[model samples]
Target: MRNRSHIHQLFEALAPKTEQKEKMLQNILVQSRNEKIRHRGFAPVKRLRSAVLAAVLMAGLTTTAFAAAYMGLDEAFLKFLNPVNHEQAQYLSNGAYVVDKQVTNENGTLTIKQVIGDSNLTYILMDFSAPEGTVLDAARYRFLDNDITTRQNFQSVGFKALDDGNRSDNKISLVMSVMTRNSIAGQKVHLRLKDLQAADPLPGIFETIIPGTWETEFKLDFKDYSTLYPVNQNITMYGYEAVLKSISVSPISITLKVDSSYLEEINEAAGELKEIGDNKHLDNFPITINYADGTSETTAIFSGLYLSEHISEQILMIKTFENVINDKEIASIVFFDKEIPIQTGR
Candidate 1:
């Protein structure tokens, strides 16, 4: 967590107990490092106490409309993002499937509450609780493991929001989403949460990690809401004329594949104009999803991109909606001014 100026101010205003805990954590990490140097070898490091991150950093206290006691995939996202239209919201709600499986240890319990997916993304709701103290929070705690191991390969993962309104020192109501890149929907996903530790801290925000191995192996079973269709639609983005490769739609997100023109070696004589049209300007692509009902929504292109097998030949531009979207209800996708009609199953 890079320290933004505002985050430091917020920490200064935190409770004294929280302040002390942060200092204590920094000192403890230093102490741990020293201990490691002193020891010869062949010894397991002792773990430290974990803290609950009650503050949902993304929403900053904005409460989303969560209609149910248990949040579905849509509710989890809505808690920290813009509200979707009624119909799209309903589709998201129906697609969410429960995965009540959980694992408990001395630190607390880590439960896999629910999971939902599309062809390119997986959204998982996880709850971590500690009886001794709150140990999981977006502000500070995260799984030691970086990627979710799949039978095929290791998939990159990211955190969405931490539940803000829980009672425990940690978010007693802590809810976190682990989004993965692999298209492993409807298949089993092997998760090894070695331990929870201090997340990338917003410098001076706080330090101190909850330590304990919740070495639990579980399977992720969820509904696959993705549909793939070839889209030969021509696009003129940033003046780069190229065919829109294809699209994969699911309730969670939409992915667009575009041909990469950057593969050519830098030709200084060709002028800078050639490179300008490539993926360099994809972030500026204005795409809209128009539904059959006459409603349309603009996409918020995701900041980061997934790894591509053929990186030199093509680029994958990921787009997400403020609210969830259903594929069947989609009538066409508008790329800039051109509207490409979507014929389901075609």
Candidate 2:
């Protein structure tokens, strides 16, 4: 691994080199114009115009040179900063690993930590205080999975919060969930919180507002795994920890539905469905239907809004039809809905 200090030095080198080049160009332009005026005795107006044009051209050349140099420096710095083998450039290009920091508070105590991992999975542990004499209650953490589209398939395990009251140290432990992706169909998962309180409501309120509830979207792709593991067994995991002041219902929910007929039609056609209905009132939701077997199809409906918020508005609808095929009542349906907020980092 390249030392952090070395990276800083490299970055510093970039600035001085860039400045020196700019200074040299400026000096060159000044000397060139002075020589032109002295040797040619060109008219003041003509000389001035020539100088300006020359300066513009020089500036353009300088910009191009600077860009090339900067790119070279960037690549070099990345190579040095990467701890893994330099030969693994392809792995770095793909979304394989990431690092992050988190803070958490329980009751009144607080703790913070860092999270890092490869693509398969990782975990973060959080320890926080509990209200005096306040017994442990239920706890949960939420996050958004926006990168589902890039991966083949993605699965996320919820954070497991544990209370260890036996030790002299009073602390609540939190184990961040694991998220895995295996496919390209992108999807996002929202987090929701409920039931929270604090003795010092002001600080809690400030933290809530400062950090607030935010959504994190991730692009899922596994091309990076080939560098470290067998293609079929590549999995990356990471972990994080955060404090909790309070929990409340967030205005976000995700609904996944599968339809059967859409898949059937596609299979019959022997191609991907290219055209879909444009439901203007439904906020242009995208539908995907897949066939799992000959007799049944899975139709998935994704809405930009929550069904609860707009179901009464008649903004979207799903209609199912049943037909007797081979003495079986096969079911198929069309699905639609509005979007909803996704929770992140509780």
Say which candidate scores most in TM-score.
1
Error of 1 at 152 (Å): 4.1
TM-score of each: 0.60, 0.25
User: What tens-digit string does per-residue lDDT give for candidate 1 at 1-346?
Assistant: 2223333333333213776879987986786577557653634432211111234423433443222212344333445332234444445555666676688877678777776666666767777776764545445556656445665443456554455555345543333444344477556656667556554445423243656665444555555677777887766555555567788776557777766464232122223422333223233455788887888877443333444344456656566554455567788887754677776531
lDDT of each: 0.55, 0.32
lDDT of 1: 0.55
Q: What lDDT tens digits, residue by residue, belong to model 2 across residues 167-222?
A: 33434455443433222222332322222322222222311211122223432222
List residue ranges in candidate 1 displaced over 4 A: 1-90, 134-141, 152-154, 171-182, 195-208, 234-241, 261-282, 291-297, 304-312, 326-329, 336-338, 343-346
Candidate 2 clash total? 40
TM-score of 2: 0.25
* Winner by lDDT: 1
